[model samples]
Target: MSSENLDVSSELKSDSSFADRTKSVSIAEKTSVIAVEATSTGVEGRSHAAETSTDPLAQPNDELNKCVVVVNKESGTVCDLWDDHFEAELLERLKANGWEPGLKLVKGEEIEETVVAAKSRKIGGLIAGGGDGTTNSIARLMLGSDIPMGILPFGTLNLAARDLGSPLEPLDAVASLYPGRTREIDALELGDRLCLCMAILGVYPELLNKSEEFHGRNWWRKFTKLGSDFFKAFLSSPKMELSLGMDGTKAERVKSRMLIVVPGHFQDDFGIIPKRESLEGGKCTLLVSKHSSAWSLFRMIGNFLLGRSAQDPDLEVKSAATLSINALRRKKVLLAIDGELAKFKVPLKLDLKKRALLVLDPKASEE
Candidate 1:
């Protein structure tokens, strides 16, 4: 049998084991644990303590409204402005709601430290402001924890927040915080690292590297720079040889130009994109692009705009519960998870941590 055929057989066998693991947790136990964690973490019912106390504006109400607002002060455009005014306005809004907002500036290598502080203080919810990178960092911190998360979109292509209908305006989102809604969102775990949106390799990762330079530049300049980078990459994009393992099975090698592993649907101008059908069933979506000409790249983009990229002949799409990627040679490639760029390494493994994140999305009904 061909390697592709063997991979299909292996994938089917893994699905049964995945289902058994999910069925072991009871609904009641899940609910009780989440509630207990929320209350203990400082998010439950202390909205008005600061006002009643003798001290004036005592520590800006850290007790009742436990929040760690993570912002990337270095990101370009409105993110800097957003971070500048975040604390004062956030505290005001939380205070109005009878809660205190804890503000923490995530500076030089302090992401893990801030998360630890929030957990130690038993804060209620985590608010991630800035772009996708900042959001992913905060989400990774709260993974497997019952503490709910809120988004304050301030980055280019606030894809995750756009899906939740929360725009970049801090006070506007804060105003809608009362009677908050929650949704169980999917997460992808690659080795020790957790990704809340997607794990991307190839051309997209390279584009992210270019995008970082345009940060803080004018909007028009940023757009122009991006277009130039895209054209350059499109012209010289090299094919990659990779081996993939699904759900702990043996590996299958394939040659491709790009690979995108997604846990949920990412939004664009093409309307509400649907994620992989088995997303909630403990699986991830893998898209591998075959070697193609410039014209083929244009067609793929056009098809994606028309909401038909999956049907394009040059792309291969599949669903898997767990995936591992290995490069044939040790080449320096770029990798991105939720728009954050990093150096690529060989033997990248992704595991499905199904429905592990509690995201606040008042717009969507609970599943």
Candidate 2:
């Protein structure tokens, strides 16, 4: 089988969670508003703005009385994560927890526009559903805004959700976030973009993600094509020389096959992606690799995944509040940002932004 593009949960437990609930109309169609069931397509919540105030954005100042649920239908695991009536059930859950709820099932391209429109409704909280990439997009969109966000892990890995102590199960996740409770968190800024987790620059992304499309037939063909690409990327100058500077210090030269940067350090040498120490630590850790070849790097990663860490000289971990990296020969480098692939310009700069986001945290309220 072609392995998953990123680490994901092996078993996606399908839990049964449902009850009667109320729904709101989309904030976009305020002129011709009509009552619709909570689960109706493109539906939103009971607009307190519509009934009480002339301005549509008449939201409460302190309490999160209303929430808009935005689900990216194209996310990898969304199709199997919930039932057809999930929208209704989710709205009901929010209602039971004292929230005015709205629902929008949108394709990937419509996510930003759909969300921005809802935010104009002055929603108290924005509950975003998708994988790490989708969550990353929403978090970036909400940055510097007063709106807090809640995450539903419906994509592969769901690393961001894991960091937030959210349940991998969809309903359990929603149930966890009490209506008004939220936690402030931080992020790492990459140029103009935001990274909630980590950014990796290395040969693996170049090798695996370079394929524009894997056509032909059968799983073996796909795996064979992948192996071929891996070897080619490996053989084509597997190592790159990089100049790194931390906290505006002078640059130092280093050779690496893979370089990993995290908003904070990853503690415990276990799991596919280990848990972070804290999200608001205001420090970044750079895991630089000196593994000689593709095979060696693979072994090192495998060791990490399998929960074994020997203090080998091949790996170095450095910490900084701000970092600069320049590849010696390459103008742009293939990168994995929160498990999504992109090509970043040379001289990548990274820094920490503390208390940048307020995410719904049921655990915090429960505590």
Candidate 3:
């Protein structure tokens, strides 16, 4: 199916968040204020009185008093951050704010079990200490539960955490969780997988698949495999028919080179990266590069640089509430969800779940 244009400006508005201007406030105030920001959309979906009404820390909220922090020790930056005494310092800081926070350092495979154990204890909140994948994994468990979550952002590219308004600094992020709010963010669903940021298809996934064949081989073998994979993917990338809507009415067929699907409210940095203004927005953007041409890649780059939406003949972008895809060849499609590669059976359906996650809200900064 061809990508159809949809309007999403109304869905891109910024929500209220804690402001950096109050940095000089007392430690208690810091806890209450950050919690106030987190619960900005209060129980009734209104502003919490804590913002300008009452002290959140003074309230007898058991959920806000106890917390668990999950660290992916294998993540690229976690070891470095932890070695610098980040955990001890944060624990001391949080304890001073009257929190009984616990820490759990786990390998990648142990993530699911750790989440279950934490939830079984009915912890007030969870703070993920890694990159997007780790954050996404933790979030999946917190869905439909009262357990709010926070992020430590130790990944190579913590896009999901950044989109949720988390700071890059470990100290600021930790301190901001003194009191946390439950935020419902839109999540993408494809089969059993949850995509927090974006889902990728086409040449990138093909290249990922090909490169894995030489993953443990020597450098020369990996380098040679990369080149070979690129040429093969460029020539052999499959054609697909994209169908939109739950009923599968809208359709377009393209000789796909690459396809990137992002939440309707993806973050915008005015850089080469794709921009979406709202995570709670119930919409998504489909960025498709047709014909698999090298020149189309350059055009995509230029469009991003110029802040122009993709509407050219070779490349186009569509924003919608949901979409579906089917391989014309009816074969397994290589897909990448939040940077992790996987294979999904075709005729895949994707839809958005609005405000499906809760996170510690980072305050707005003038900088």
State each candidate's clash count: 8, 2, 12
Predicted structure 2: lDDT? 0.68
In order, what lDDT does every prediction score? 0.58, 0.68, 0.61
Taking all chains together, each candidate's TM-score versus the true structure is 0.72, 0.76, 0.71
| TM-score-based ranking | 2, 1, 3
- On lDDT, the candidate that comes out on top is 2
Candidate 1 local lDDT, 291-317, one digit each (tens): 478788888777776778777898888
lDDT of 1: 0.58
Which regions of candidate 1 deviate over 4 angstroms? 1-66, 76-87, 96-98, 106-108, 210-212, 216-224, 266-281, 331-333, 362-367
List the lowest-lDDT window of 10 residues for candidate 3: 6-15
Residue 28 in model 1: lDDT: 15
For model 3, how does the per-residue alpha-carbon lDDT over 1-367 read when each residue is reduced to its tens digit? 1112111121211111213222332221222112221222324421443335322222333455777777766554554445324545776666665566666666677778877877776456778877666777787777767777878877655677667666667677676665644567788877656788888887776576545422111335544565566666665655655543433565766656678888864343455444456778788888877646567655655656666645456766778777878767655677767756667666777878778777666542212
Candidate 3, superposed: residue stretches over 4 Å from native: 1-63, 96-98, 211-247, 265-269, 291-293, 311-313, 364-367
Best model per TM-score: 2
